[model samples]
Target: MDESTGLTIHKSEAVALTQNGGLAKAIKPLTKEIHLFDTYVAGVSYLKDKTVLQEIKIKDRLTLQREDNKFDDKAIVVLSSDGKKLGYVPEKDNIIFSRLMDAGKLLVAYIIEIKKRSIDYQQISIGIYLVDF
Candidate 1:
């Protein structure tokens, strides 16, 4: 059963339930990802190794962390998978996402497109998704 969309799985598509109930206990809750918005990563020019941007690819997952101490109260810092600082979610776009984070919602970002104009100029577009279980 998919709770988010109220969709039921046909028996043919369902996993068999174990008689011992161990499988039920091991089953994880299903989660649905809702795309909230897409935006470019801000301040990429400030990264130490701009060349690292070339290594990023479409559909790469990124991490978003709230920076409460930042000058902008709504700051959300974006990071690469290996913990590299990849700039921010852009000030104009962080308010709603920051609020959702403050309210304990699970949010994720993924690279949707990467356009490289030169060694010094590149644009990373990411899509933000809300993970609902």
Candidate 2:
């Protein structure tokens, strides 16, 4: 059942059970492997499931720069067609880059903020922030 906050406490408890310690630690590798497996499966499915839709071409490719000036092999490109700007997609972040090559018109390229939080043994939470595309 949904709680007052529209969340199921039992589900949260289940996730807590699989947290960083205890059973979670033991099965962490397995969880990662499963995640990779699922990604591979979904990628294959998308490739096999071709759409009978029209092709949309993007005008230009945008360069993604990191705030720290770190060079990476990937960048996010916003693509569009019909001379109208469309939404941006994080490139290389998606499994099917080639498929989305001609989906929309090219727009702006800028770095976005990324945040990560972690809890240590003492249960103190630390947050790390980065500007990445």
Candidate 3:
């Protein structure tokens, strides 16, 4: 796969979806059968190309507050696959973000939104690539 193109694609196995509580186990005693439910595809794209599309409303809302002073002293944390903190990317910096999507590994993204006097993001999009053979 080409990293320069900024594309990510991977395959995953579907497992049983269980309820947060003991709802499934409680119902198991009432019935002896378990049926498969509906399924849907979840596609998450993190590219900055024309082919990569994002909702206009979300994009607009993300950059609604465009000001310098608002993000002067804010903290932005970046993470790696092993739950290690990489560093912080400035609010208005153009960053090329990449991540690995292993078969059973989890990807985490944390964003702390703070309502302040101003906001600004020089780079609105992130580049993503999947390099699994």
Candidate 4:
């Protein structure tokens, strides 16, 4: 009401603009990444030892450490959970992976499956998962 002018104003009930509800639910967590880079493990002299690949179990976590001090700067050695040397990442993929590791990104590798019958990749197969904070 406007007392000075003796005028009055009326308003209708407020209506919500939303049809169903508020904002949609937060986006689902991203599925873990699984990238298989070419592995140099095939022709490496060390895999020659039948026992080196022994004791490796499926779903076993692996650690990738940069071998900058070694002759191959891009060399990323794969280590078992028990600190055993599994092998080196392929040269083509090692550079990218090395940079990612040096950048302090968290990546986890696990023995996805063991190919006992397959002619290729017969030792074991691995999957790398990205760890998001």
- Top candidate on lDDT is 1
lDDT of 3 by residue, 2-79 (tens): 598877755332222244555656555654322211111111122223122222211121111111335443333333
Q: Model 1, range 1-133, lDDT digits (tens) per residue?
A: 8999899967532455544574655454566789999999998988986655866788988989998655788988888887788889999999899999999998889999888867687889999999887
Per-residue lDDT tens digits for candidate 2, residues 25-103, read: 6555553111111111011112222231123222222231222214423333232222222222333343233223224
What range of 10 consecutive residues in model 4 has the weakest lDDT sum?
19-28
What Cα-based lDDT does every candidate model obtain? Answer: 0.84, 0.27, 0.28, 0.63
Q: List where candidate 3 sits over 4 angstroms from the true fold.
A: 1-72, 94-133
Residue-level lDDT of model 4, residues 11-125, one tens digit each, is: 5322232234422222224434556452433233455454546677787888877776456787777777877777777676667777788899766677777666443335556
Per-prediction backbone clash count:
0, 6, 1, 0
Lowest lDDT sum, 10 consecutive residues, model 1, at 11-20
Tell me the TM-score of model 2. 0.16
lDDT of 3 at 59: 16
Q: In model 4, how many backbone clashes occur?
A: 0
For candidate 1, report its TM-score: 0.75
Cα error of candidate 4 at position 53, Å: 2.1
Error of 4 at 7 (Å): 51
TM-score of 3: 0.20
Better of 3 and 4 by lDDT: 4
Which residue pairs collide in model 3, if any?
A: 67-119
